[model samples]
Target: MTSDSRTLQIPEHQQDGAAQKSCYQKLSDEHVEELELYRKNGLHPVHLGDVLNNRYEVLHKLGHGTSATVWLCFDTQTSAWKAIKIIGASHSSDDRPELKFQLQLSRSDLVALPTDHFWLVGPNGRHVCLVMPPLGPSVSSKHQTMDLEALREVSMQAADGLAYMHRKGICHGDFRTGNLLFRLDSARINDLSKGDMLALIGEVTKIVVETDFGEEPGSISPRYLVHSLNTDIFADFITCQIAVIGLSLAFEITKPPKTSSVDLPYASPQLLLRLPPSTHSDVWALGCTLLEMQTGSVFGTAPFEIMQSMELLLGPLPKPLQRTWSRVYPEEMLHPEGNTEYLTWRSDVISEIKKHTRNADCLLKELAMSRKQSLKGLLAADDKNKPGSIVWQVPEKQVTQIGDLIKQTLSYDLHTRHTADAVVQHVWFDQARIHRKPRV
Candidate 1:
């Protein structure tokens, strides 16, 4: 790709919306409603033959979300491919202006933001159209699978990216697995060229979709690429997509809000409880996202279900949540009238499970001890009734270390939670660190 280094101001205005509207002006507003339906229900408003901003040609629809419909397009000026996010919301106020912020960020390692963004008024109204280098696939895209090492790399980089955003006072209020991108360049560590990486990807995902996100900047890969040479180049090929790609940021990336519907599965207890949002909440999102990237599921279906899962997987609610439980959660939410499991906590449970560790913070430790004792006792009682039943075991040491960090990320108390900066250095990422240390 050539360097169109023309001082990098935003692109000039696109082809006039009026000019484009003339062809369809004969159609009644009722007919236009049908056109609107094109994008509303997973159809492309612009045909493949159409051009955007007179500079971008619509290639195909990559994906769509609540706010905008994304199109893979060709940038005539830069002669590169870009993803165009056309905001569906009529007002421009809802769009994120961080494309400029992304271009100016101090860290070059972050490939999660687009190369550039600009606006275009459309037939509907003024739309804050974001033009950025394509983000390859949603981290949740069905075509890919990653092993543990690949996942670790993705987690560490994600944490580092979140740290960079938080330090800059930018809350990527909607950071989740789906928003993350995987860019594919040639796997240099594997000694594979760009062509090889492409071939590897085809073998991995098992189906060929459009693979181009952007060219890798140089022969040297980023720090996130330092994993043990994975055997399945196909998986890591998709994995390294994260290693060598540029990303885009669109809307709602402002100061952390009290709450937004966008933050699901990863929303912190504080935010869920209608408390003030903070940068630390982003840290919580990073943690929750890493867990889902591994587990491949949302935290739960509803708030109550999520709370139960978290309490079981991590420890109980921190003291703050406990204190407000009555005020915030109704009896139905805490213990649905028909669900006996919620009411079974008493002396019987205290005898079965033991405290996991004595090293947790005082509040966490006490809660952990109590919850575990109850859980263990209940399990023992069930076993006594059944005689010999299948046994359950705790996660191994390394896994427990990682689980502990995840719990810290999911901590109800911000004080007990792990910061994005610290999470990158956690023991869970130790193996990846060892590989990078020698080279650094």
Candidate 2:
């Protein structure tokens, strides 16, 4: 069932010689020749740009991963730009026939998502493109110096998206910043000019370069200009997309949390252990994202570092981060320090920040007066009665948020954990304040 095979219904003319060279009998000689040409020239299948795919004119290559190459193509019928990800037979370790079967399975999963789902998906009969609205510039927490309220909104929107994925029982296995796309509009941050923001957007939109006969036809060019300050539903759409990408990419891992799964940095304990992703996992990652947004750097070294720290301070990494981390570093990670070590380390980091920023009181005050005033609710309590007050509970949510993030993303467990779903519903999500507007 190679892409070139009759079983797949791919036209013979479109089949490449390289595809034929595989064990699958479906590949044509032409497919094999293409593979040979690529092998001879050290050109990857990804390098072949502007090839025709039925009615679509492939304009340029988007990005390449270990298993597939995505292209930004132009649909001749609708005259629209689309992303087409072509998974080649040679890319898989399995036999071409087996690979085809797996692709069929994956393709089915690809289409299972809802039409409004911002994540990737393929339409019926069409090869998987994972069509998404064009991406715009990202709102870097570090770059923009967001108030607490703005940060909370970003987190909430991200939670909503991740929760949606978990509800569908789909895991975004390879979440990253590059995968996130947003709407482009005019936004004024403080005194920053709208034109300045648009210029930044221009830098991030996927680039396209045309070619002739697999040869360099010309230089690369920008696809379009995205305004950053436009206020409308479109703007919210873009913001939501970025929020999704932000959650997915947090604490990306190079290895699985355990031998059987991949562990995302900042994943909850459950996620690190190869457990099904849940809201907890999403929360853990969001905490890390917020930290990154605040610190302007990727935190943590390896699973052991975070796991050891979290274990000493509290216990196992949160279920969410654990699930994702388990997939990356499956070798049984544990916290090194006991309770004292954990407590000391936690206190040190917080105290250090407070010392430098004067308890972040000024910042919080400004945030309370800004558009993010709703977020203060996260720090305050709903009621002073009952067993415990909101202040005490707020710390729990914050701790769980941070701990789960560290555990899920940096732990060694590979099973029995939460995922994006759990993270979304964590105390952190339930606690964050949502204000109408904060005074600037």
Candidate 3:
């Protein structure tokens, strides 16, 4: 077949939602010539078992989104399995302002973002097909739930990946459970047995040793030695940290909090309001995703519902929120003092969850303890703020400093937020021996 080129119409706004859906819809009406080019260049139609790019032999369809269809494929050359996500673009697109702009921007800046982070895996080419690691079935596919420690390990890796991206001034735009993958046995470095329901329950639960809270200060904890053995997180941390050394990107000012339901509960408040996401956004999503992993839920709310809910519960915005919002969202009309109210609402929600749900309550207790220890260093630093109040719950002798850093990484404000690189320098990462050179 001869090379054919065509462009299909894609709405400007929809480009950021889902790439798979965008590709399929954009290509559905494209000219025959463009279709010919796709077939000739290796990105054939969404047919089962058809090989694309002569390298990836489609084995089965994995999942599909607006812009693309992901297929489980085998590499003819490597004799290894891979994920191929086809984002079909045409040569004759008449309209697609948002998509065009994003594509143009991605093309210019995308390469700048380091792709070597193992946890941040994706395809190597951009012509149309997005390559990725071969993913096992969903977490639920193996068992109803995973070990909390395993999930934490996975999250730590994801954090490393996000830190790398943030350092490079890149935002994932969409961060969700669906985007993560569990490596297969053949892909694993060690001969460790594959996970199953039994493994989920039987795997040793990791205990924390190094205390972030000052309450545990001067305490020697053996549990701190149980940091994750997951390789992806380490690789991501190393590579991303190197790549994101210097890049300036626009960051949004948080507006005052109006009492609205979370639009994308998993997305950071900044990103939810269309602000440029930063390391803090990644931390926020990580926190939300951790909640999702515990509860098995996705996060979102319709605009109308959000507004109605916020108005009913919050009553009215506080002054500080109004000032913050005015600076963040000048064009959008928002409740004058919404940000402060929103934070209160958030605290209330967490408190309510702790009171109501056993699982959430337990987690909140653990996290709260962790949070207290995280600020241990600053506790004495701000004795003026502490007056007579005790800064920590656990005795200072037993507290771990790592707990404190983790808490700050998840701080609410964007400006006061610590960079991912900064987080890696914490005692936890250091004690984990993540960056230490192996003895020759």
Candidate 4:
């Protein structure tokens, strides 16, 4: 079917030139999916109250990505909350390697697998709909002021999840904070009545899609676009059980993926160098993820910039890779001018490193202050009266252990990188007190 067949038909008033073009309300792209994408092989138009397969009732939009839109749905038959991911019609269910791998490891608690699957024939086209247990927002979306204990919990859970996947011979080609979702309290969430759930999540914000001549959106787009569900209410119920998600780039160890589309900031040197993806590359990405979680920022924004940061932080690139880097990015491009006095690249690299280091230091300082305050409260002593407080200093042993672990995973040589299993068993993770209690 042609894209035109799926698009909303222009109103007769506009066709006859009776209505003014300027009368229509133009919708902002913010907080909503692109209206232009609702076509023949694009996103399936899903409304809040719509029911799919005569069972799952769409409650709110959980999130969306380039290829699919995830909705928080209530399954009438099972009376359970589910996150239904509706893949774009352009992608075929049978051809998706993600589906194959997820099905293989469906029983894994560390990974978010589809509990059920079905096809939805919409105005756009037939799309693959995956039913999964609803999960909270990604770790990357969490507040930067997250406590050290919570951070440790996230780190340990993520490492454990990755280790599980690696043990199953699956390589999560794109391993990053964005792909790690915090597990919600299923029993608590499921037990909530529809009205109670709505009250907790707050009202859904929606905007009417206005077109030229005030044309109805028709079947192409949703009648009203819904803002993604606010999951802040579930923050207290968020568990340490993190699940590794987004398996579209995942591949098996025996059959390496021919093509990879990892985000540049999280991508390993092997991937950036155009080498085939392997489990080693996943480890490199994991290192970057752990560092991001600890520091509240990525190492760099661009590929060349990240490579430069990698060199400074993880030591110089391997000899062969250094030669390849020179070939890829010539000296003239990196240095620009022969004069060392105005070396912007070097200055920029130094600035970036200092910025991240300062962020890490700030987090460490916060942790130390928290510890000091806790001790003061426990001892019930004033700062001036306490002689032991003068000499008391928070130990940096955990910092050193975590640094060693990250260094091992972010090793220059892929062979020298820590395996996923080793990362989980690291000394740093031992400090993580695994508990489901609410964050203080």
Give lDDT tens digits, candidate 3, residues 1-440.
Answer: 11123223333332223322324232342211122122222232443346676666654455543344556566677766566655534311212222222332343221222111111112212334556554444332221234433444454555565555555444444444544445444444122222321232232222222222322212111111111122222221122111111111222223212322222655554554555554466566655554455334433463223333333322323445434544654432334444434332345643653354323234345554544543454455665732232333433322334235434554446676666566655554443345343211
Write candidate 4's Cα lDDT for 286-361 as tens digits. 8889877665556677656677667656545666876666566665555436434222235564465555542334
All candidates: TM-score: 0.63, 0.44, 0.45, 0.79
List the global CA lDDT of all models.
0.51, 0.37, 0.39, 0.72
Please provide, for model 1 over 388-422, each residue's C-alpha lDDT reduced to its tens digit, 9 standing for 90 to 100: 32222223554566667777787777787877788
- State, as a TM-score between 0 and 1, how close model 4 is to the true structure: 0.79
The candidate that achieves the highest lDDT relative to the unseen native structure = 4
Query: Scored by Cα lDDT, where does model 3 land?
Result: 0.39
Most accurate candidate by TM-score:
4
For model 3, the stretches where C-alpha displacement exceeds 4 angstroms are 1-44, 90-127, 137-144, 186-263, 294-300, 303-363, 366-410, 422-440
Root-mean-square deviation of candidate 4 = 8.7
For 28-84, candidate 2 gives per-residue lDDT tens digits of 422121222222112233322344445445443444443444454555665544455
Evaluated against the true structure, the overall lDDT of model 1 is 0.51
Q: Give the TM-score comparing model 1 with the true structure, all chains together.
A: 0.63
Task: In model 1, state the lDDT of residue 267.
Answer: 74
The deviation in Å at residue 206 for candidate 2 is 15
